[model samples]
Target: MPDPSTLTPVDRSGGVRMADVSQKSDSARTAVAFGRIHLGEEAFQRVRDHDINKGDVLTTAQIAGIMGAKETSKLIPLCHDVMINGVEVDFTFNEEKEAIDIRAFTKSFGVTGVEMEALTAVSVAALTIYDMCKSVTKDIRIGDVHLRAKTGGQSGNWKSEVSAEEPAQN
Candidate 1:
């Protein structure tokens, strides 16, 4: 293994450094992240049937996902703050597992990838689901959170190795 010192710091001056976006041209960037909250059948039915006392769980979660994306930098240290062009949150019901699948897509025209933002959105949204459904299903477990894809920047484009079992969705 190589010595850790062999790798140069982002800034040789040893001072805190933001990415050097000055030289890079602005380009459209996007990222997708996935997450799931496994719920008991009773809780799933409440969400599926719009019977939750808090109203629509899916809608609430979707909005939470977007807000989470915007507040990513605040939630995760070391993440850069960037203007978000757009964010989309999709929710799907899995009858077999009695769970809610969450996918967050975020876009921006900036120097940094939205990977953290995408992931944060799904995580917060999953937590929101648990908060809303805890009354009926205290055992709900958040699971399978991962990035699906990202695009733009100097590296061009990138797509995550998402499995066929949970294909990327709109």
Candidate 2:
């Protein structure tokens, strides 16, 4: 890993500042992140049965995920205003844990990577789940947000596929 001193901090003045993307080349960058929202059995069933009070959990969360990617700059203090080309979110069930696995894939034709956007997507989606199910289950948690893989940019392609045994928590 590069030394911390060698890397430039975003806010040199102890405030907020966006990255300088001007010198970087525009590439077809893509990143995939995975996260989990640990809903109790009751909450999971409520989502499965389409009985959540606010609305459809999966659909609404999916839309929120996409919107999250687009609006990442507005949320994260130092993230760049990226031009995202695509964003996809998938949710599945973990029978053993009785929870949901959310995977977000984000693509951009820009100078910076969209890993943050991907992570933000998962975060917002999980939050949406908690929001929609709050009435039914107050114990819902949004957890284990991570980047599974990232492609393009100076670092090239990188991947980290966590084992199934080490489940995400939230």
Candidate 3:
């Protein structure tokens, strides 16, 4: 979520506004977000064994994720148009949870932070996975999407303090 304190230009009736990053100095910024798609037994096995007929699920999802990050500003109304420098989307199979763990890392050199990009990356990736595996079963669940960490901007650096809830990913 965008920091509430970073928002500005509240109206008299308490209407919220987007962050005005115009005056903020340009700096190297990065963010990481995570989410998962619970594909159940059959879908999970098919994805893990690379037997899905919709081509390589993970590879296609990764590409879609990067594209989604690039278009974050267009998709979200309050988001600023930041020039993203890099984006990485990765996935891992969780046998115990019958899920695919997704990780998205976004980098930028801009006045605004890229946490929204990172979040869009993971969400789009998870949605892509659901699309790919929906043929096997429509009983997929996407949840637990959250920002793991962010660096740069006025916030400096921040990370999720709930270490125990972090992904068991690389």
Candidate 4:
């Protein structure tokens, strides 16, 4: 993934303005992102057993994530309103880490890429898990958020060499 610092700020060139993609032809684009939420033993079990008082943690989080991806344009200013063709949010239980592993995939055919949407999906999914499981434990920690891969854009295809499954201690 490109360093966030390397990305052009909205106001970096001249005055603030949305980048023009009008001349760029629409193309199939997709982005995948990953995130994790660490939970205490009790909380993890409650989630796995669907014993949370807030209801099915994974299902609820999945839905919230898709919705979040759809709302990415509104959440982040300057993002072109790309029509998302599909969105998927899947979760895995990492027993060793005692964490819920989140993966989000977003698809779109547009001049702009759907990287932000994919990222937003993972973020909202992690946040949803934290929200629904907060009552059981407050130590819930969300981290290791990063884009795994992206395709179809002027920048071309790319994948991160670093694994996003583990959160950095810092």
Candidate 5:
């Protein structure tokens, strides 16, 4: 007989499965994720001046990010359909790096953490920026997608080790 106790995210039958959180107590969970989209000079200028033909690029991306966060379970396999309590997408234009930094904060009171939701938000926001600005420049690049911080759950609190050497953007 296969030992069910040793199975994790997969059964002895070799089928992927979602983790059962039925026994876990509901708790307040939050996650913060970050990503960056590098835009060419022209595209960056257009985004900064709200000159993109696709409407307000940043605002549109922000909206898309929130929607994405709510739909994370639908997009990613094995993710639980969590009821997100809040989602916030913020952006920072780094002229020095010719990139726009995207940050997503997600909160939920559930059995599972909201890290996937936060990551999905940042990823979708970066993609939306690329889609909106592709007409101006094809040199767009998305990178540095990672979890910046997270709290709650059995893991407790965590934070990224990235240094705070960069100047704050308005």
Candidate 6:
């Protein structure tokens, strides 16, 4: 026997497999993730004023984020395809830092937590903004993608010690 107690994500054959959540009980789970895209001053103005040629950046990105959350399992290998109960994507324009902050909240009533889904939402939202405004400025940078908090599952609730500071208006 391969010592069931010591079984890891990889089997004896050395192949990666999704974690088996079959034994886990159904529970309400929620996760929040955040990210930001630094768009230079001129580009930021265009986005803030909705003057971008591509269209409404925030609205389009929000929709993309929700879609991304639902499709997380397809994009990330080994992630379970759980039924997401809800997904919310919000954006805040930070004039002081010349960046747009993205926050994604995901909820599920399933065995696995929705942390990955929340993260995917933030990442895709940032990417969508980049894609929409790349013509205006290739200098845009996407950074600070992180999981802010998570609740439920076997581990219970947890929060990140690094708090995100709101950007001040110019």
- Candidate 4 regions exceeding 4 Å error are 1-14, 164-170
> Least lDDT summed over 10 consecutive residues: which range in candidate 6?
161-170
Predict model 4's lDDT versus the native: 0.88
Q: What is the lDDT of residue 40 in candidate 4?
A: 78
Tens-digit per-residue lDDT, 1-170, candidate 5:
56775776787677888888898989999999988899978999989999999999999999999999999999999999999999999999989878899989999999999999999999999999999999999989998888989999988999877747333321
Residue 56 Cα positional deviation in candidate 5, in Å, after optimal superposition: 0.2
Q: Give per-model CA RMSD.
A: 2.6, 3.2, 3.0, 4.6, 3.1, 3.7
> Tens-digit lDDT track for model 6 on 1-170?
57643565666576777788899999999999988899999999999999999999999999999999999999999989989999999999888889999999999999999999999999999999999999998999999898888999999999887654743211
Of candidates 2 and 1, the better by TM-score: 2
The residue pairs found clashing in candidate 1 are none
Error of 6 at 44 (Å): 0.6
Question: TM-score, each model?
Answer: 0.87, 0.89, 0.89, 0.89, 0.92, 0.92
Model 2 misses residue 128 by how many Å?
Answer: 0.2
lDDT of 1 at 86: 94
Q: In candidate 5, which residue ranges exceed 4 Å CA deviation?
A: 1-7, 163-170
Candidate 1: where is the Cα deviation over 4 Å? 1-20
Candidate 5's clash total is 0
Prediction 2 global C-alpha lDDT: 0.86
Expressed as tens digits, the lDDT of each residue in 1-170 for candidate 2 is 65544455435445445557689999999999988888999988889989887888999999999999999989988778999999999898766666789999999998999999999999999998888888887887777888989999999999886777545421
